[model samples]
Structure formats: C-alpha cells, structure tokens
Target chain A: MKVLEDRIRQEGLILSETVLKVDSFLNHQVDTELALEIGREFGRLFAGQGITKVLTIEASGIQFAMAAGIALKVPFVYAKKKKAVTQAEQMYTAPVTSFTRGETYQVSISRHYLGPDDKVLIVDDFLATGAALVGLVTIVREAGAQLAGVGCVIEKGFQEGRGLLEEMGVRVHSLARISSMAPGEVQFVDHNDPIRIKEKV
Target chain B: MKVLEDRIRQEGLILSETVLKVDSFLNHQVDTELALEIGREFGRLFAGQGITKVLTIEASGIQFAMAAGIALKVPFVYAKKKKAVTQAEQMYTAPVTSFTRGETYQVSISRHYLGPDDKVLIVDDFLATGAALVGLVTIVREAGAQLAGVGCVIEKGFQEGRGLLEEMGVRVHSLARISSMAPGEVQFVDHNDPIRIKEKV
Candidate 1:
C-alpha cells in the first residue's frame, strides 16, 4: 500500500480537489507488475475466505479483477456495462449511476456464471461514488451468492463510497485511501495509527 | 494453443457460420491460468523482438494485454472505447466499426503512454473483421512506434482479417486459426502443412 501511495505521489496528476488521475500507470496505461502486486495484497487480505469468484465491472476493473483471479487461482467475471450482441442469455441486472460520466447504465452478468453455490470477492480500480460497486453487490445478492467483501485499488475516503458499503455491512479495503487532496497536495489515511479502524492487508 | 483449441471445442457455442462464442473461458468469465498460458504462447512467438509495451483495446482485450504484459515483463496500455472523465488530455484516436455490435466507436489512447521510442506488440481476444485491431494499428503508427506484430487468441481464418493485415504488410499470428465452423463443427487451418507460407511461432 505504501508503494502504491508513493507511486500516486510521484505520478498521479491532480486536476482538482475531487479529480485525481493515475492514468500514467493505473487504469488507462497499466503497470502489470504493480497490478499483480496489488492482487497479491488482496489475496493476502482475503486469504482464507474460500473465494470462488472475483467480480468487477468492465473496462477499467478488468485488469485488477484478472490480477486478483490470478493471485487467488479463481475465475473472474466482469459485469458488462451494456448488453452486447454476443451476450443474449438471461442475465442478472442492476442499474448504476456514474458520477463522473454523468449517466446511468445497467450492469449485467450472465445468470449461468454466478449462483447460490458461489462465494464472491468484488474488486475494482477506484471507489469514489461507489455506484458501480453497489450495483455489483446487488447482482451478487440477487444471484444468491455469498459476499466475501470489497477490494479497491484506490479509494476516495472523503467520498460517501465507504459509508454506503459499510451501511450494507460489506467490509471494504482499499490499497490507497485518500483522506484529502488538492491541486498539489494529497493526504492518505494513516494506517500506522493505533486508533485506525480500517483493515490492513 | 492446443489447450485453447480443446477449451473451444468443449465449451464454445457456435451460434452461426460466422459467430462463435467462447465466453465461458475467454472473455466474460476469464480463466486466468489459461489466459496466462496464452500470454506465454504470445511471448514465445514474439520473443527477441524487444517489445517495450503490449497494447490492445479496452473491455475484452484488457485481460490478454495484461497477460502478455506479464509474460513479457513490460507495461500494457488499453485504448479507451470512449473518452472518460479522467482522460482529458490530447489523445491519438481512430474509428472502428464493430461487426458484432453493428456500430462504430472511436478508440483512443493517451498520447503520454505511447510514442516514437516505444516498441509495441498488439494483442487481442479475437481477429475476425480486424476492425478494432486495425484501429489500434493505426494508433500505433500515428504514435510513430515500432510494431512487432499483432497477436490474436483466436482467428476466424475464413474471414478477411488476416488478408487485410497482410495487405498492410503487417505480421499477424493467431493461436487458433479456424478455417471454417458450423453449428457444431469448427475446422482449424492445419499448421503441420509443410507448404504453409505464414510464420509459425
């Protein structure tokens, strides 16, 4: 996590108080070695959960989900943002509103993939408004699968994302937790503090 | 490649003469180990090419790109299907028509990630009409990057994809080259033929 935080400090572009872009290495362009390390961190955090599957939304989250799946030696399923021509089977659906994109879209997964017999671990690239993560949680429940927890590569702790997931009794863990950020400076939640309540990998 | 061919034979659903679905293991729900193996195969094919980066389009191509990046020990970049909120910088863009979705979309990559000094090996999940792959090739050319070649997991050899790339004087290698396919049968172009002109990896 410290390594991620350091990389964020070194390469992250802070556009505004609310906008931080790590496109240089995280999402748009990726560092595969770093991604695998992040996955290993997730695997270490959820080592004994008996996770049957790793779930995520398409595009951005696919790499991280794939990484976690590789680390845990399980298959990863990414919920499609929109139904494609090849995907015509019956699906479990949930609607999500994107704060950044300023649109609402349906996230769906084939019903054939997840069911009551599965235990799921949800992963994603960023946790800000938590809309997509919440939608994924709904689909996981709808499929009658056991929710292990949520793992995020980066979390905007100042946002309401963690609060919303915590209200649903979903344990949330983030590699880089941003307590605050500005045009030039960024602050992370101190994990070394004895009073820090969040779980550490 | 044999393992991939076997997986397709066992789990692939042939919807028509032109459409074959391997969502069970390739795209939607990904088998990470198999994907890694596929990456290793690509690595074996493109070894000694000095590929500085692996590239692909977003969504489905992210996993294979990540896998190849791992195998090659370099970074990977996935072009975005649409400009996201976080991506506000200048970009190199190309238009692509999706044969499956029946629509055209622009795929863009941050200009910061790729440039004249880079050596790129493009990897993707499929090579059918070569629309997306072509778009990526254009972007790589626009960036003035050296392209080693294009690597595809599966190719519908009956289609014009290979011909189109070959016409561009670009090298292409597909792991499983399907000569033909029907509702329940799929034929691969035999690699054992001594007269085959294509490079075998």
Candidate 2:
C-alpha cells in the first residue's frame, strides 16, 4: 500500500479537489507487478473466507478482479456495462450512475453464473461515490449468493462511499485510502488507524 | 495451450457459425490459473524479443495482457474504449467498428504511455473480425513503437482476420485457432502446421 500511495504521490494528477487521475499507472496504463501485489493483499485480507467468486464491473475493474482471482485461485466475473448481442439470457441487473461520465447505465450478469450456493467477494479499482459498487451488491443479492465483503485498490476516504457500504452492512477494505487532496498536494488515511478495516456483517 | 483447447471443447457454446462463446472461462467469467498459463505460453513464444510492454484494448483484454506482463516482467496498457473524463490530454486514437455491437467507437491511449522507444506485444481474448486488433496496431504504429507481434488466446481461423493482419505484414499468434464450428461441434487449425507460425515482419 505504501508503494501504491507513493506512486500516487509521484505520478497522480490532481486536477481539482475532487478529481485525481491515476491513468498513468492504476487505471489506464497499469503496473502489472503492483496489480499482482494488490491482489495478494486482498487475498491475505480475505483469507479463510471461502470465497467462491470475485466480482467487479467491466472496463476499469477487470484487471484488479482478475488479479484477485489469480491470488485466491477462483474465477472472476465482470458485470457488463451494457448488454451485448451475445448476452441474450436472463440476467441479474441493476442501475448505476457514474458521476465522472455523468450518466446512468445498467450493469448486468448472467443468471447462469451465480447462485445461493456461492460466496462472492467484490473488487474494484476505485471507491468514490460507490455508485457502481452498490449496483454490484444488488446483483449479488439478487443471485441469492452470500456476500463475503468488498475489496478496493484505492479509497477516497473523504467521500460518502464507505459510509454507504457500511450502512448496507458490507465489510470494506481499501489498500490506499486518500484522506484529502488538492491541486498540488494529497493526503492518505493513516495506516495504523482502525478505519483500515471497516465494519463486517 | 492443450488445456485451453480442452476447456473450449468442454464448455464452449457454439451460438452460430461465427460466434463461439467461452464466457465460462475466457472473457466474462475468467479462470485466473488458466489465464496465467495462457500468458506463460505467450511469454514462451515471444521470448528473447525484448518486449518492454504488452498492449490490449479494455474491458476483456486486461487479464491476458496482465498475465503476459507478469510472465514477461513488463507493464501493460489497455486502450480506453471511450474518451474518459480524466483523459483530457493528447491521445493516440483509432476508430473501430464492432460487428457484434453494430457500432463504431474510438479507442484512445494517452500519448505519454507509448513512444518510439517502446517494444510492445499486443494481447487479446479473441481475434474475429480483427477490427479492434487493427485499431490497436494502428495506435502502436502511430505512437512510433516497435511492435513485436499480436498474441490472441483464440482466433476464428475461418474468418478474414488472419488474412488481414498477414496482408498488413504483421505477425500473429493465437493459442487456439478454430477452423470451423457449428451448434454442437468445433474444429481447430492443426498446431503442428508451420502456418501456425505466422510470417514475422
């Protein structure tokens, strides 16, 4: 996490108080080694939880979800941002509003993939508004699957995302928790603090 | 590669003559172990090429690209499917028409990540119409980067994709090359053939 935080400090572009671009490494262009390390960290955190699957949204979260799947030796499923022509089967669906893109889209997963017999761990690249994460949680419940918890690569600690997930009784863990940021400066939540581990159901 | 071929034979759904769905382990729901193996296979094939980076388009290609990056110990970059909010800088853009979605979208990558000095290996989940791969190849060329070749997990050898790439004087390698498919059966291009080793540029 220190490495991630350091990378953020070194290369993260703070466009404004609310906008931080990690396109250089975390999201757009990726450091594969760091991604693997992040996955191993998630695996360690959720170890012994009997996770049957790792879930995430498409586009940005695929890499992290894949990494976690690699670390935990499980299959990872990505909910498509839109239904493709091939995805004609019945699906578990939810609506999510993206503040960055300024649009709401439906996210869906095939009913064939999840069931009451499975345990699911959700993972993603960033936790800001929690819009996409909340949508994924709804689909997981709709599938009658057991929710293990949520793991995130980076957390905007100042935002309402963590509060909303905790209200829903979802345990959340973020590797890098940004306390605050500005045009030229950024701060991270203290690692020694108990907030690193959110409340678990 | 035999393991991949076996998985396709066991779980692949032949939706049509052109559409073979391997979502159970390749794209939607990914088997991380198998993905790693595929990456290792790519690494073995492209060994001694001094590949400084691996490239792919977003949504599905991230896992394979990450896996190849791991096996080769290099970073990977995925072209964004759209112009993102954070991506406000200059970009290398290419327009691709998706036969599956029946729409054309522009894929873009920041100018900072790729350059003439870089040696790139492109990876993807499937090579069907070669629309997306051609777009990526164009971006790499536009960036003035040295392209080692394109590596795909599966290729519909019956399609025009391979011929198109070959016409462009670009080398390609696909782990599982399908010769044909129907509602219940599938055939692969014999791996023992020298044609499997595409003419290198």
Candidate 3:
C-alpha cells in the first residue's frame, strides 16, 4: 500500500482538480513491481473467506485482478466490454456508468465461469463513483455467488464511493484513499474510520 | 508452451471452423497460475532485448502484459480503445479492426509514455488477422521507440497474422499455434522452422 501511495505522489499526474491520471504508473503505463506488491497486500488482507475467483471489468482492472489472483492462488475472470465472437448465450448482466469514460455500458460474465458455489473478490484500479463496483456486485448476485470483498488501488474518498458499497454490506479495501484531489494536491483521508479503512484494504 | 497447448485442449471450445473460444481459461476467465508461467516463458524468449517496457492494446492484453512485465521487471503500457477523461492531448494513434465487435477503432497512447530511447515488447492474448499488433507497431514506430519483439498466448495459424508481423520485420512468439479449429477441434500446430520456435529461458 505504501508503494502505491508513494508511486501516486511520484508518478501520478494530476490532470485536473477532480481527476488524477496515473497513466505514468498505474492504468496506462503499469509499474509491475508495484503491482506485485499491491497483489501481495490484497492476499494478506483477504487470506481467508475462501476466495474462489477474482472478478473485474476489462482493460484497467484486468492487470490488478490478475496480480491479486496470482498472489491469492485464485483464478480471475474479466468481464469483456465488447461481445466476444465465441460468446455463449447464457450470461449474467448488469449496467454500469463510468466517471472517466462518461458512458453507461452493460457488464456481463458467462454463467459457465461463475456459479452458485463460487465466492468472488472484485478488484479494480480506481474507485470513483462506485458504479463499476456496483455492477460487479450485481453480476455476482445474479450468479448466486457470494461476495468475498472489493479491492482497489485508489479510492476517491471525497466522492463517497465507499458509502455505496458499505450500504450493500460489502467490505471495500483500497491501497490509497484520496480525501480530495484539488489542483496539485492529493489527500489520504482514511484514518477517520479505522475499521472501515481496514475493511477497505 | 506445452502447458498452454494442454490448457487449450482441455478447456478451449471451437465454435464453427473459424471461431475458437478459450474464454474458460485465457482471456475472459483467466488462470493466473498459467498466466505467470507464460510470463516467465516470455521473459526467457526476450531476455537479452534490454526491454524497458511492455506494450499491448487494452482489455484482454492488460493482464498478460502485466504478468510478463512483472517477470521481466519492467513497466508495461496498454493503449486505450476508449478515451478516458484524464487522457492527455499529445498522443500516438493507429486503427485496429476488431473481429468480434465488427468494427474498426483507433488505439491511442499518451506521448508522455513512449519515446525514442525506450525498448518495447508488444504483447497480446490472441493474434488473428494481426490488425491489433500492426496498429500497436504503428504507435510504437510513430513514437520512434525500439520494438524489441511481440508475444502472444495464441496465434491462429490459418489466419494471416504471423506473416504480416514477419513482413514488418518484428519477431513474434506465440505460446500455442492453432493450425485449425476444425468443426469441434482446436489442434495445436507444429512449427517447422526451428528459428521461430527454439529459444532459451
């Protein structure tokens, strides 16, 4: 978590008062050394509860989920944005709105991959409005699977994304929690809720 | 490579003669354990290239690239299919046609990430018509970066992908080469050229 927080300070670019671009180190251009460490940290936090699989939406979340999957010795599933050519008919679907892309799309998982017997840990790069997490939670419920928890590299705490997931009784763990992203400065803002922050991890 | 071939044999499904799906364990549903091994194998193939970075088109490629990036201890960059709000103005671009999506789209990389001094290894989950790889190569060339090589988990030998990459003078290594996906079978194609298949870890 410290590695991620330090990297955010060093390579994460503040694009505006509301958005931070981690392209130099996180999403676009990935720092694998840091990803490995972050993956290990997730492994530490969710050592139990029988994580049968790691679920994530495509693109940015793919790498992080794979990292955690390796650390936790669990397989991962990527919810594709596009309909794959060989896709099956049976799948669980949910709608999601992206704060960054400014689009609402359907995210789905094949029924063949996820089932009622599975417990899933959801992972992603950033948690801003919490819509993506909500989408994943919806898909998990559709499959009759148990939600192990949610893990993120960075959480925009000022956005109150945590409250949305907490309302669903889902534990959210974020390596770096941003209190505010104003101009050139970023804040950690997680010590106020020690128990919740631990749940975030 | 044998492991990948075995995985395909075990879980890969063939839909029609042209479309094959390994969504059960490759891209859609990822086996991180196998992903790690494939990453190490790739590191062995491109070991002395002095690769400063690994590059790929986003969605499916991100996880594989991240694993290889970790194995090689380098940073990895993934081009975006959809533009993010935090994306920069200066960028390198190329057009890629997606078979599944049945459309042509541009893949973009931030100018801040690519440069003349960088050694890049382009990676992806599958190589079909080579459109994505070629588009990725264009972005790399536009930035004047050294393309160390290209790596893929699967290559459809019946398709024109490898020939196109070879014509471009870029070395390509595919873990499993599918000669034919005849009706219900996905057969692993053998390479007659030792130069293309033989390498050390």
True contacts kept of each: 0.90, 0.84, 0.98
Clashing pairs in model 3?
A172-A200, A173-A200, A173-A201, A174-A200
Expressed between 0 and 1, the share of native interface contacts present in candidate 3 is 0.98
- Local distance difference test, each candidate: 0.90, 0.88, 0.83
Off by over 4 Å in 2: A191-201, B191-201
lDDT of 2 by residue, A1-201 (tens): 888888887788777777788877888889998999999999999999899999999888998998899889999999998988777778899999986798999999988888898899999999999999999998999899999999999899999899999999999999999888766777788844322211111
Best by DockQ: 1
Tens digits of per-residue lDDT, candidate 1, B1-201, equal 799888887788887788888888999999999999999999999999899999999889999999999999999999999987888889999999998899999999999999999999999999999999989999999999999999999999888888998888789999999988776677788844322121111
Error of 1 at A124 (Å): 0.2
On a 0 to 100 scale, what is the lDDT of residue B78 in model 3?
93
Off by over 4 Å in 1: A191-201, B191-201
Over A52-155, each residue of candidate 1 has an lDDT whose tens digit, in order, gives 99999998899999999989999999999998878888999999998778999999999989999999999999999899999999999999999999999999
All predictions: root-mean-square deviation over Cα?
5.6, 6.1, 5.8
TM-score of each model, paired residue for residue: 0.94, 0.94, 0.93
Stretches off by above 4 angstroms in model 3 are A190-201, B191-201
Clashing pairs in 2: none
Q: Which model is ahead, 2 or 3, in terms of lDDT?
A: 2
